[model samples]
Each structure stands twice: as structure tokens, then as C-alpha cells.
Target chain A: MNRITLEQANAVIAGAFAKAREMALKPLGVAVLDAGGHLIAWQRQDGASTGRLQLAVGKASGALFLGISSRKIGDMAGERPTFLASLAPIAPGGVVPAAGGVIVVDANGHAIGAVGISGDLSDKDEACTLAGIAAAGLTAQA
Target chain B: MNRITLEQANAVIAGAFAKAREMALKPLGVAVLDAGGHLIAWQRQDGASTGRLQLAVGKASGALFLGISSRKIGDMAGERPTFLASLAPIAPGGVVPAAGGVIVVDANGHAIGAVGISGDLSDKDEACTLAGIAAAGLTAQA
Candidate 1:
């Protein structure tokens, strides 16, 4: 299966940061994960703290692994606290319900990867991740 | 003006893993950082989970940025959640005020960096980190 390669991930990060700058949002840490939920590429802003990057990777990994957006995961996680708690220990790179993560899809409607962004509000983080997907010639899951 | 060099950080990571192997401890994630709290080097043993890497980096980065060991900083963070919370939005690297990170001191007693070990209990993590520092010909800050 065609996967989101490192090259595409880099482009997405570039696009995400560009979008962040355009929107005048805070510097961000963004992560792109392949369909297998492994990181394809990641970048942390010079000023953004380290936690943002870790969380970004986790959020992206979770979105792709579960084939769901972060907001949806949050809702489900909230419904099952025990499951969520157990889940966190296993998914070092997955943060089920964090904001700023979205699944990447191809034009043909295939799941490709997930993009996670941090260091901004949830909506802004989502916007940046969406921009990244769009930049990679992929579409963000609506 | 003493600060951790990338080489020193890499050495700490390598030494920590070597010690873990020698002791037959669990696979480990090791992180080392400069005084400025940036990633100088990091590594994870093959069998170690991703969470280990994240937590190690978090603890090390937190200690360096806060100018205290994780043992001390964790308490501070717990008590001053708002201060730590405000810092969260600023850096791309994650910082945790948890134990397992140790400040590295050179022969002259100047802090050169910090070593953090994960994939074990907090005490074990600290022990591994100290062992790694010894391997690197350094001392842990008291």
C-alpha cells in the first residue's frame, strides 16, 4: 500500500508551520504519522516546550491508529475512563482525545496518515494539521 | 559556561544502555540535554517502549529548564501547577517534573548536562542514569 513517506511528512510540517505563521498563532510542534502509526516526520518549534512534541506525536499516532479524529477519541475516552487509562500506558505516541490531531486521507478516500499539532489552541492546532494535509496533496478527514 | 556537548549527551545515552545490559535490567530509553534544556542526544533500546523515551526526555528537559533535578522539580510542579502549565505552551519539547533525571557534573564540579533513564521504576531510572554518568566519567549533582 502506498504510505505517507518521509518526504510527504516533511512537506506537511512545512505547510503546517506556514499556516501557523499566517494565522499568527503560537509556534507549534507538529507530527505526521504513517498508516501504521509510526512517525514519518516531526518538527518542534524552537520556542515550544518539549511536551508539545511528545503529545503531538501521540495525538497523531492515536488518530491514525484508531482511524478517528482526536476530538472523537476524546469523546469515546471520556465515556470509558478505565479503557482510556489502560490505553495511555500502551500508546506512548497515542493520546486518544487531544485536540489538534486529524486523519490524513487521499483524494481517492484512502486513509494515509495522521497529523498532530500542539502549542496552540485546539482549533488552531486543528487548522495547522489540516493545512499540513492539504500541503501534502492529501485531504484532512472531515 | 560549562554546558553539555552533543558528544557528552550521546555518551550518556550509550553508557546508560550499556549499563542496563550489564545489569540485565529492562530495555531503556535515555535522554541527555544541555544546560539550556535542549535535546543533546537521546536513544531507546530496541525492546523499550516509546513511552520510555518520552518520559525520559520529559524528565531531563524539565530538570534542565527548571535548574533542578526531577526529584525536586516534580514537587514544585505539583505545588505550582500554574507555573508549569504556563511553561507547557512555550516549548516544543515536553518537560515533566518527575524523577529519573540527574544533572551531570564534570570533574571540576560544573554542570555539563543531565541524564535521564526510563523503562524502569523511578528509582531504577535514576540509578541507571547515575551509572551512565559514571561510565561517562561524570558525577551526578547531589
Candidate 2:
């Protein structure tokens, strides 16, 4: 299995921050998780709020845990709020069915990891996350 | 002041896992914290218990918050049980006051971060945490 590497994680984080800067978004926190749902790398911009890190981690790991984009999960969560709420406790990182999370696919089309962005509009966060994965030469399931 | 980088944290984790493998210790969980006591990195080896991650985080944060090794905290806790019991609620990460947490120091003798290990004997966990810091060419205040 191809696990996400630290260099790749760094590239993703740098790309996300660059996009955030270009878009004039607030200071963002980004987290990357390996295929096994373990944290590969994470960062918080100097002025980012305290909870952004955990939010990013939760989003990314939620995506990884579900093997789908968190946007899709959000839609599902909307339809089944009670079930989703119950599911959070059983999930490793706990679920946050939101738009900022995307699954990263490797060359073989395997879900290799996930990238999550926080501290901006959900759509903008998703854009930055996808851009980061693309910047690392990977594809995003967003 | 030098802040602990993701690269250094990765090195430390890798070194700790390598030592754990070398020593044939049980599956372990390790966590790294920044100078401000925020989580920087963490991993639970395959088959490690669910609680190990939180345990590692608490121990590391406890050490960082107190500016001393968790082993020392444990000793103090033994003597001042009531004080240590009261301290946990005041600490952000909820102090563990046990072995397996060590502060990482920079060349100028400033505390940079901390490493905490769990899922092994407390003494062995402390040994691995110190070994990981040393392997990364960082000093462990153990």
C-alpha cells in the first residue's frame, strides 16, 4: 500500500497556504492523513484560531474513515442527522460531515489519504484542499 | 528560539518506532507536541489499544506544561497526591503525571517540544521517548 509521505504532506500544506494567500482567505489550518487514517502532517498558520487544527483533523479523518469526500458525507448527514450523530463516537477521529475534506487518490486510483482545510468558506476550503492535492501530483475526490 | 519542525517530529517518531521494533516492545503509540503544548504529530502502531493515543497526548502535554519529564511529575505526584490531583483539572491536556514523556530541548537549552510514548511499560516507554529525541539529534530533558 502506498502511504502518504512527509514530503508529499509538506507539498500539500504549502500549496494550500499559497492558495489561501492568493485568495485572501483567513489564516488556515491543514491536515493530511495517510491511507490508514494516521496523521501524516498538519500545520496552523501563525494567526489561525486554536480549534482549526482539530477541525481540520476531524474533517480529513472523517473523509478517510468514510472513504468518500466529506461534502458527500455532509449531504448524507443532512438526510440522516440522527444516524450520523450516533456514528461520530464510533469513528476514530470523530465525524464532521463538512465540505473542506477530500480524499486523495494515488496513480492506481486507490484512496491513499485525505487533505482537509479549515478557516475559510467550505467551498473555498475544498478548492484549496483539491489544489493542494493536485499540487502534490495527486487527484482529489471532491 | 528554534521551534520543532515537522521534519524533526517525523524523525523522532520514526526513531521511536524503530527502537520499539528493535526492542520487540508491544505495539506503541507516540505523540509529539510543540513548545506551546499543542499536538504536532502522533501515531498508534498497528494493534495498539484505542486509549494509547490520548494517553500519549496527555503525558506529553503534561510534561510540556510543567517543563519537566513526566517521570519527575509522577514522583512528585506520589508525594503530593492531592496537589497533583488538583492540578489535572487546571491543565489543558489534563495532566497524566506519569513516565514516558520528555521535553525536547534546543541547542540554546530552550524547551522546544516533547515526545510521549504509551502502550508499553512506563520505564520502557520513557526509554523509547528519550531514544527518539536523541536519535533526532535533540536533547531529552528526562
Candidate 3:
């Protein structure tokens, strides 16, 4: 299984920041997680909220846990709010049912890692995450 | 029940690390937990991953919960994945169905505490944990 190196994790953070700057999004928090949902890297920009890191981790780890993007989780939450609520308490990092979380996949579509961004609009946060993964020359699960 | 003192907890960490170094293993994270599974002490060697601490705690706490080493929990997980996964949410620290968690016991075989190690193969991690417990003059649950 492909693992995200520290260097790649850093690069993903840098690329996310670049996209956030290009879009003039609010200060953001970014997190990269390994296939096992362990943190590989994390960063919170100036002015980002104190819980930004947790939020970002929740997004990324949740995506990895369910093998789906957090956006899809959001939809599921909408359809089954109780189910999502039940999961939040159980997930160690957390399960934030929102957008901005994307799984990084390998050539065979196996999840190698994940990236999550927060602080801006959810869609905008997701855009930066996508940009970051692309910048790292990695593929995001479709 | 006798509690593992701070000094002994630290010694466990030191001994585990010494064994790790002697074996040329990767950097590790270790956690010593009291009988109630509260952390008495923890340390992460340089180069260990960010979530190593949590993983270590999960192992130790899981051992305390089930009254067995995490290796046994791992075997249980293999036999009943859903059962283990269901427990992960309710177990506060966590129930990482893996090795590297060993319960420290008294002469009468009553649990006093647990030691957990991460950042290497499960068996290797368990080996260091055992060595640490021995160095601290503690008996592992038989």
C-alpha cells in the first residue's frame, strides 16, 4: 500500500495554502492522513479558529473510515441524521459529515491517504483540498 | 488494587525504548496506563508519527477493558470483525484490536496497569512492552 511521505504531506499543505490564497478564502486549516487514518501532517493558518485542526482531522479521518468523501457523508447525514450523529461519538478523531474531505487514491484506486480543509465555505474548502492533492501529483478518489 | 507509580511508568517507557534501540526498530510511542486505563505517562520517540500517542493509548485501554492483552483482542477481531468494531465506539480510549498492549498484574494476577507500544510490527511492539514491564519489576498478566 502506498503511503504519504512527510515531504508529500508538507507539499499538500503548501499547495492547499496556495489555492486558498488564489481564491482569497479565509484562513484555513488543512490535514493529511494516512490510509490508517493516522495524521501525516496538519496546519492551521493565521486567524483560523482554535478547533480548526480537529475539524479538519474529522473530515479527513471520517472520509478514510467510511471509504467515501465527506461530502457524501454529508448527504447520508441529511438522509439519516441519527445514524451520522451516532457515529460522531464513536469515531476517535471524529466524523464530520461535511464537504472538504477527499481521499487520495493510488493507481488501482486504493486509498493511499486523504486531505481535509476547513475555515472557508465547505465547497471552497474542498476545492483547495483537490488543488493540493493535484499539486502533490496524487489522485483524489472520484 | 495497587497503582503503577509515576516512576515505574517512566521506567517502563525508558526500558521499552532501550529495547527498541537495541533491536534497531523504528521510533516508537509508548503509554503506561493505570488500572483504570488512565494515562500515567507517555512518550513518543523522534520520527514517530503524529497519531502514535492515541494508538498507544487505545492499545493499553483496550487491554484493560477486556482483561486480556491486545494480541488476544486482535485474534478476536479476526474472528469477529463486527463485534470488535462495535466495541471501538463505546470503549472510551479505544479498542484497537492489535498487539503491543500488555496488562501489568500483581502476584495474585489482578491487573495493576497496562503498557502499550507503537511504531513497529505488532509482535515487535509487544516484545518491547514485555521488556519494559520486566525492567520496571512488574509482572505481566499470565
Candidate 4:
């Protein structure tokens, strides 16, 4: 299976944070996970709350576990909030079911992992992650 | 400057776990970092406890920041626990000042990164990490 490298993850973080800066968004927290849902890299801006880290990680985990962008998960949750709420108890890494989580895909179209960002409007966060993923020469399954 | 590749990091993990198994140690969590102290990879065995991940990363971070084996820092920490305790609040990635963290050295003798393992005794963890580093044809400063 294709895997996201640390260099790639670092590039993603740099690109995302750069966009966050240019857009004047709040301090952000970002996380990258491998295909197995294990953390590969994470960064929290100096002013970002510690909770942002967990939230970012949760979003990525939710995306990987559901095999879809977290925006989709969030939309699904809108119709069945209770059913989706139950997933956290059983889902790997406790799914967040929110926007800002995107799947990273390899050249062959395999989902390699995910990139998640926190500390902005959920849509804006998703946009930032896309920018980062693109910077790393990867595609986001949005 | 030679950077550790994801392939090398995966090889390190495989080597480390193989050593753990040969010695019949408990399930382990292992982490690798780049020279900049950014996480490169991490893994927690199926039966490992949740906290192992953080502990492993913490140990690696402590070693990377201090430019010394965590075993040496642990020894110093024992002599000054209160002073060592103060470091976490200000240190990068929060210091763990314990054994099981070793710096990965490149051919030029530069500290390229670090590897940390948690699960068994600290000494045993350190030994396993060293074995893994050797298997990857790298040296561990421990």
C-alpha cells in the first residue's frame, strides 16, 4: 500500500499553515495519519489550544474510518445525528464526523491516509488541508 | 545532510518489534522523528495501551532536544527531579527524561533523528531500539 512520508506530511503542514497565514485565519492545528490510522506528523501553532490537536486528529481518524471526507460524514450526521454519535464509542480514534477532514489518495487512487486541520471555519479548514495536500503533490478525496 | 526515509523508518519499526518479540517483551509502541524533531512515523502494537504512544514520542523528543540518550538524562533527572519537572512546560514536545530514547546518527555522525520505544523495562526498550537501528544499518547514540 502507498504511504505518506514524513517529508510529504511536513510539506502539507507547511502549505496549510502558509495558507492559514495568508488568509489570516486563527492559529491552527494540523495532523497527518498513515493508512493504518497511526499518527505520522502533527503541528499545533503556538497560540492554538491543546484541544485543537485532538480535534484535528479526530477529524482525520473519522475520515479514514469512514472511507470518505469528513464533510460527507458531517452531512450524513445531519440526518442521523444519534446514529453517528454512537460511532465514536466504537470507531477507531473516536470519529469526529465533521468537516475539515480529507482523504489523501495515492497516484493509483488508493486512499493513503488523511489530513485534518482545526481552528478555522470547518469549510475553511477543509480548504486549507486541500491546499496542503496539493502542495505535497497528493490529491484530496473531497 | 542525510535524512531518514519513511522506508527506513518502517524498517526500523519492523526490526525493533522483531527484537521485542525475540525477547518476549510486552506489546510496544515505537516512534521515529526527523532531525527537526517532527514525527516521521509511529506504531502501537495491537495489545499495547493507549498511553504508550505519547510516552514513546515524549522520550524521543526529549532525546532529540537534549542531544543525549534519555538514559543519561534520566540519570540526571533523578538527581534533580524538580528541575527536570520544570522542563516539560518550556521544552519542545515536553521532555520525558527517561531511558528508551536513542538518537539516530548518520554516517557523518550527525544526529539525524531519534527512535523511542515503550512497553517493557526502560533498559529493554532501549536495547530493542538499538537492535532496530542496527538492522537498518544505522547507529544509535544511547
Candidate 5:
């Protein structure tokens, strides 16, 4: 199994921040997690909320838990409110059930890691996450 | 119910890691908990992620919480997701509805302790847990 190295994790964070700056998005918190749902790296921009890291981790870890992007989880949440609500408690980092969480996949389409961003509109956060993955020369699971 | 001694707990961890090395499995985090759901011993192999210890403990403690293996909880989660999710917050250390947790039993069939492993596939982790128990001359609850 391919593991996301710390260097790649840091690169993902830098890339996400760069994208956030380009879009003038709110100061963001970003988290990178390995496939086991363990945090590999995290960063919170100045002025971001104190809970931003938690939210970021929740998004990323939740994506790993369900094997889907947080955007999809958001859609699922909309369709099955009760089911999504139940997942938050059981999930290690608590499920945010929102966009901004994206999975990074290897050549085999197996998830290697995930990236999550918070502190802006969910769509904007997701855009940064994608940009970050691209910056790291990794593929985002569609 | 008999209590698991510290010495036995250490043996369990050593034995589990031995089996893990033999099988060339990924780095692992193992936790042993007494019947009261309190930690007796814990070890996280080099290269394992930071949150691994928490996950290891969650699996064992969760088993004690429900009086069954975490594998059974995983199956229950599949059948009744809401029911399993509801138990997480109330349970100490949280509940990880996954395999890798096994209850240790005494000759009288009384619960003695539990072993939890993480940092690999659920089945592989559970296999190590069982091996650890056996190495300590304990039986896994059927």
C-alpha cells in the first residue's frame, strides 16, 4: 500500500494555502490523513477559527471512513439526514458531512490518503483541496 | 471475572508483534484492556501513526463495552448502522465498529480481558490479536 509521506503532506498543505490565497478565500485549516484515517499533517492559517483543525480532520477522516469525498457525503447527508447524523458520533474524528474533504488515490485507484480544508465556503474549500492534491502531483479520486 | 496482569499484557503485545513480523504485516498498534475496560498495556510499533493508540484502545474498550468482539460490532453496524453509531459517544474511548478486537476468556468462560490491534487490515489485526492471546496461554471468546 502506498503511504503518503510527510513531505507530500506538507506539499499538499502549501498548495492548498496557495490556492486559498489565489482565490482570496478565508484563512483556511487543512489536514492530511493517511489511509488508516490517521493524521499525517495539519496547518491552520492565522485568523482561522480554533476548531478549524478539528473540522478539517473530521472532513478528511470522514472521507476515509466512507470511501468517498466529503462532497458526496454531503449529498448523502441531504438524502439521508438520520444516517449521516448517526455517523458523527461513531467516527473517530466526527463526520462533518460537508464538502472540502477529498481522497487521494494511487494508480490503482486505491485511496492512499485524503486532504481536507475548512474556513471558507465548502465549494471553495473543495477547490483548494483539489489544487493541493494536484500540486503534490497526486490524483484525486473522482 | 479474572483480571489480566501487567505481565500477561506485555506478553500479549510482544506475541502480537512477533506474529506481525512473521507475517510481514504493516506496523501495528496494540492495546490490552482489563475486564473493566481500563488499559493494562499498549504499544505502537515504529512507523505507526499517532492516533493509532487511540484506535487500538477504542477497539478493545469497545469490545468490553458491548461484551463481544469488535468484528461482531462491525457486523451489527452493517445491519443497524444507527444503533451502533448511537453507542459511540456514550461509550468510553469511543466505539470503532471494526474487526481487530477480541475478548480474552478464562477457563470458566468468564471475560478476562481484550486485545485490540490497528495499523493494518481489520482481519489481519484480529489475527494478531488472537495469536497474542494464545501466546499468553489465554483463550479468545468464541
Candidate 6:
């Protein structure tokens, strides 16, 4: 898989914010992480909810740790809240099992990194995050 | 150096955030960890200021490394910007080298974990963190 560089991470944030501004949505916070889930770049739009950053990291890290998009966690949670809750201890930090974060796959479809967004509705956050992945020319879905 | 458990870490955060809310402060972000500086758990209040969680992690982790308090760094930085800047990268989490966090310690004063709070002024952030540490029955330098 091609390494996701800081250049790409920065570009994703720039493009996403531009789109968010174009829409005049409330402030947004975005985060980009390496495949290992370490912070690569993050930004909080002026007046954006601060937790947006953590949400971004959590959702992105959750996807990366599980090697799947966060959206799938909800599907598997039918009667397994206890098992799902175990993930937080294993992963450290927090994990949100939903699709607000999208994996950034290399051209070969190998996982490389992820992008996450928060500060809007959950769906809006997911939309902005996908917009970022698309702007980076990466497939956001599994 | 005992490893910090996620449960212990979350306990600190839950307590701190509850107190912060009780005091009518703005929403907050809190992170806890152990001696190795690994993250245990983190939470960002819904309306917290942007970047509060990351800042809190950085502040708390930074204080842990120095065996002092983040307040000391903040005060010293006012007169020693270059020194603090040089120290920022020592932690990969973008430590601000300022006040607002404290290291969690063991009875023998061994560094264990840390908690950082953001979403208010630096002083208030520090106050909240102190409140959290106090809630944990651990001591902190104001």
C-alpha cells in the first residue's frame, strides 16, 4: 500500500474545509491519521465543537483497528454491546462504530490511512469525511 | 511502572467531567493514561471547545514527562518560548508545553498516568484537571 503522506493528509483537510465552507455548515473539525492511527494532521474550524477532533480520531482509529469501515460495527451490535464495549479497552482511546470515518485505501485497495470528521450531525460528518476521501482520489468504502 | 488500565483511566475522566459540569463550566475533553504514556480512554463533551481533547492529552502527557506540572511550563514559557518549542516534539502528540494537565502518580510518586482537560481557559483547564486528579485521590501541582 502506498504510504499516506502528510501532503495528502493536509490536502484532504484543505479540500474538506473548503467544501464545508462552501456549504456554510456549522464549523467542522477534521482529522487524518496514518495507518497506525497516529495523528497526521487535524484542524478545528472556528467555533466547531472541540470534541469533533476526538470523534474524528476515534472513528478513524476504530476503522483502522478493525480493518473495516466503522459503519459495520453497528450491524454487528444486534445483541453484543458487552463484546463491543470490550473494544474500547483493547483499542485504547475511544471507538465509535459507525461510518463517519472512511478508510483511505491505496490504488491496490490496500488500507493506508483514514479520515474522520465531526462537529455536524453524524450523517453530515460522514458526508464531509467521504468528501475528503473523494477529494484525495481514494475509495472511501470497503 | 505499572501499566495504566483503561478502566482506571476512564474513571478519572468520568469523575472530572462530572465535576466540571457540576461547576457549570463549559463542556470538556479529558484523556487518561499510564506511565508509558499510552492512551487509556478519552471523552469529549458534546459542546466542548474545539481541540480541547487533543490539547488535554498533550498537556497532561507533557506534564508527566517533566515530573512537574504543566503550569510551571506555561509560566516558564512566557519567558522561555524557545525552550518550550524545542521540547514540544519530545511528545508526538503536539504538546503545547503549557499548563492545563497533570501526571497521574502512584503512592510512591512514580509516574503512572495523566489527565488533561481542555474547553476552557488554560487556567480553567488546569483547574478542571486538578479537580479530576483530586477526585482520583492523587496529588497535583497547581
Best by lDDT: 3
**Any residue pairs clashing in model 6, and if so which?**
A50-B49, A50-B50, A70-A98, A71-A98, B34-B112, B35-B112
lDDT of 6 by residue, A1-142 (tens): 4766655776787778777877667877777776767665566654454366667788888888877766676556556788788887788646786657778887777878888877777777777788777787667755
**TM-score of candidate 3 relative to the true fold:** 0.59
lDDT score, candidate 6, position B88: 57
Supply fnat for every model shown: 0.02, 0.09, 0.02, 0.06, 0.08, 0.00
Task: Tell me the spans in candidate 1 whose CA falls farther than 4 Å from its real position.
Answer: B1-142
Ranking by lDDT: 3, 5, 4, 2, 1, 6
lDDT of each: 0.73, 0.82, 0.86, 0.82, 0.84, 0.70
Cα lDDT tens digits, model 4, A25-76, are 9988888887777776666665555477678888999889989988898999
Model 3 CA deviation exceeding 4 Å by range = A1-142
lDDT of 5: 0.84
Ranking by TM-score: 2, 5, 3, 4, 1, 6
> TM per model?
0.53, 0.68, 0.59, 0.59, 0.67, 0.53
| For model 2 chain A, the run of ten residues with the poorest summed lDDT | A40-49
Best by TM-score: 2
Itemize residue pairs with steric clashes in candidate 2: none
Q: Just chain B of model 4: what TM-score?
A: 0.95
Per-residue lDDT tens digits of candidate 2, residues A25-84? Answer: 987888888777766666666556667777887888888888888888889998999978
**Interface RMSD values for the candidates, listed in order?**
8.9, 4.5, 8.2, 7.9, 6.0, 13.2
User: Which prediction has the highest DockQ against the true structure?
Assistant: 2
Candidate 5 residue B7 Cα shift, in angstroms, is: 1.5
Across B97-126, the per-residue lDDT of candidate 3 in tens digits comes to 678999999888999999999888789999
Q: lDDT tens digits, residues A86-109, model 1? A: 554466464636568898877776
Docking class of 2: incorrect
lDDT of 4 by residue, B22-83 (tens): 99999888887777776655666655665777788788888888889888889989899998
